[model samples]
Target: MIQGFVKTPEVQALLDRASGKTVEGGDDRLKAITRDLVESLMATIVKYDVTESEFWSSIKFFQDGAREFGLIVPGLGLEHFMDLYMDAKDKEAGQSGGTPRTIEGPLYVEGAPLVEGDVDLSDDPDETGTLYMTGQIKGPEGESPDGAILHVWHANSQGFYSHFDPTGAQTPFNNRRRIKIGSDGRYSFHSKMPNGYSVPPGGSTETLLKAIGRHGNRPAHVHFFVEAPGYRALTTQINFGDDPFAKDDFAFATREGLLPVPQRQGDSAYVAFDFELQRSASSDDEVFSARSRAAA
Candidate 1:
């Protein structure tokens, strides 16, 4: 009998059972991740002479990583898979027109200030840059989806989002809102154009990106989450016409149809856009989305 370490057949059997049960997600990807994780652990076990402290430390590290993984696939661009699937569905259903969809970032809170077709969101005296966003929410048949709601948000001119910036003032909990589309399916808003920004330099996401020598920079853009009864909620952004980061956004959220066409109009330049919605008979609940619910 071994003195400190257990060597009994019962202990060996328990270890085997535990190892076999580590992956239970039933999804193919989960199984693959489990296989890779176990292989990685086995390599470390062989390298460091397999001790309780080393094994537990590695387990804790992985547990933290898993805990921080928000369920939103858009956070990692897996939502691109969803985009492709939805595109196929649209074509199959003969749904045509409106705006193509894109990824919604995690910073959108909820319940942003509601206004008519336009609003001034800057609310800062020194806020530089002008943004006039004009668009329409229309059905696939090109009919106005009157009263459709547009929930919008964006980074400040400095690229700092509310709630996330400790040094900066916090806006309402959700930098989001419900806007009623006009009879012509048109909507618009006013805010300072946002600047590009990096992810916090050393968070888990940044650490991994820098390890691969990748730069973290999301382009200047306005985020929108549009919903109309019968239409699928569209989570997307409109890229600033001339932002250098538009093509090289770290999040890869910029889409071909999402770049707003800049138009000079007197004292202000306007970004014109038009969005098409999938039609159906559903309530606002089916269409409207808060931040938590959107990510969930």
Candidate 2:
């Protein structure tokens, strides 16, 4: 084993300089986080005795696959970890009992048309498999949250999402909708049954998964962003329990209460589920995060 030198004064000085610890002006939070990150990376390199070639190869992998980082991050469980971390923080702060948050994979597009009451999300005439989903949003005490908005989106039958489908087959906002809930806090939508999909074949996400001896596949699921005036906004999704990948989601988004089995009703599939939202602690909690989202 190579002698570990990351803890030595020489390496410490280098890290401090590299992380801007010696700088006079900068974002303090960023600088501190950077220092910790660089220190950990240096320690890992020393611990693993990583060679220069191996390091550069890893860097080149990221450089080549930068576009797929959104998929890659969730596949690596970083996004799921964020959810888990947030849950723990909430629990520590005495916040409890609500729908579990999960990974909001990087496919959400803003500006979907908002409609009151039940809406039909299926726009393709050629699609045949029909799915009807209905749900109610309630506060922690089982009271309906008045004036809630349910933003929903899902992939098409071919697992291609609108605005990002490489085939150019999907129209704008296909399989996407925003339903307005009244005093009853109920919403519903009808859409085509979405198929489970795998990561882009031979792309960066798939290549990395292959290298790690893992398959990149996600189960059929519907994404939701629910918000109310006095309730904390929720970013969650529900996986079809019957999907083969329901328990083995590559994005690590499958949660215990989020998996709802679909019931067959003649030619269509029906799903009934309910969401519970915690009361907002502040105004900020009543809105979704400010992450960059696609708009069209």
Candidate 3:
């Protein structure tokens, strides 16, 4: 037999265990999922013609990524899984449709400019594009929530973000601002029209996409992180309806009701949307503070 390092006892033991399991109902389901995962892993190994060193290097990459997965799952769109589960639980509890929630994205920098009332978010009007977003924050039964705070951010026209962009002098944290709602729970801001941007061409995200022959384009959208005293913290994005890639976001974040209609006027446009927050019987103050810290 041709001896390969992979034929070691450890792998053999795993294979033996996998074979010995007599798959039942739940086991059958698990096997199906495991098969997909294992097949994908094997396909990747073969496609790259990965060597032992390269294989281990990729493993380390995944290990590091796994460590960050907790943060990424919430910030990078996978929180949709929790949303799905929550929807099911809500339906079982007779809760109907409410404002849709979405991924917050990875660019939210804390300590953003805070405005108790509506204000212009385009601090650098010329450098940053122009966008006028208007919306309301409602509680159950469409009632306005008092003192709801809206934290928002977006990418620049060049698709470069603040802190991530090498040209930091032009825009420190491109398109990041926090606007608080008034007693009426209504809010609006004026900013530039952000453009669609891709991930770094040679980074891990790009590398995986390229290997899979997938494009790394994200549709033009705004990020929102909303927090109110007694409501659950909501992290979401609003995709511009006209964006060609809006429905085909590489991040896979587009949701049924998350896309907003944008009406163009003069050189810019207005995007109107509303978010309904779920109120918990027990206060979520601690949860909100923890989320704020994580964003910080």
Candidate 4:
């Protein structure tokens, strides 16, 4: 038995064991995906001749990335990939809707206070310009879906989100609320127009972006999840049209359909956008979502 250099042969052996794993009678799908990911990763390492030092450095980066996983996906365009996949799936299933879907970054809390028909997300003086968003909840059939629920949240003017920022745990529901759709499928909310958020400064996320010559700044936007009885739950965001970075978001979450068309009503900024949900074949298709899974 002879051990040569720690470069190629040794790395190949390590990768083979790491990526090649067989679990007798395990879930075939999970096993297959794991093998695929492992093999691809191993191939990349071999193909690029990644050194031990580089491999360890990457391990550290990934460790840090896990903490900021929510920011990582959007920064790396993985979120958009999923959106595209879902879009394709919907199309394959013969489902079409005019409203485009976007990423629901990993910051949504399981539950928020449900309001009657309208909600005021914040009243803090430090919060920026007032925003009044009104929209209708339409089903895949283009009819108003009565009693749909819209879960809405946004960052503060300073771009701090509850449950993810300092003192966020103290006021976990700040700038967050849920509104029940009316019989006519109308819903509204009053909140401060939240500015965009950025990846934590000088953190692992930032380091990764910097290495790739990228900045981690998402444009001003608000997150929403609409749920109806028989319609698919929609996770989306509405970007401020006037924001300079609206189209250049680091998360790449902004879409034209979801952009807020500002309508000045006195001192407030009002935007009207309709949410159309695809009709789900089964309740499981729509009822189970990030919101519900988080709750569970």
Off by over 4 Å in 1: 1-75, 89-96, 173-175, 261-269, 281-296
Considering lDDT, which of the candidate structures 2 and 3 is the better prediction for this target?
2
Candidate 4's residue-wise lDDT over 14-64, tens digit each?
Answer: 644554443356566766677577767767776778899999999988986
Q: What lDDT does each candidate get?
A: 0.66, 0.90, 0.70, 0.77
* Candidate that would win on lDDT: 2
TM-score of each: 0.71, 0.97, 0.73, 0.88
Give one digit per residue, the lDDT tens place, for model 2 in 87-142.
Answer: 99998999999999998899999999999867988777546679899878999989
Rank order by TM-score, top first? Answer: 2, 4, 3, 1
| Steric overlap count per candidate | 5, 0, 4, 0
Clashing pairs in 3: 129-192, 130-192, 130-193, 131-191
Local distance difference test, candidate 2: 0.90
Q: Determine which window of 10 residues in candidate 2 has minimal summed lDDT.
A: 120-129
Point out the higher-scoring one by lDDT: 1 or 2.
2
lDDT of 3 at 88: 85
Candidate 1 per-residue C-alpha lDDT over 1-296 given as tens digits, one digit per residue, 9 for 90 to 100: 23323335664455445455444545666555655565565555656577889778756755765633442234456666667787798789786566787766667666566677566666654346577877678877788775678887777767787766645674543234567776888887776666778776556666556766777777777788887766767777888657787888767677788876567564356787888777654564256444453321
lDDT of 4 at 13: 65
Could you tell me the lDDT of residue 263 within candidate 2?
Answer: 99
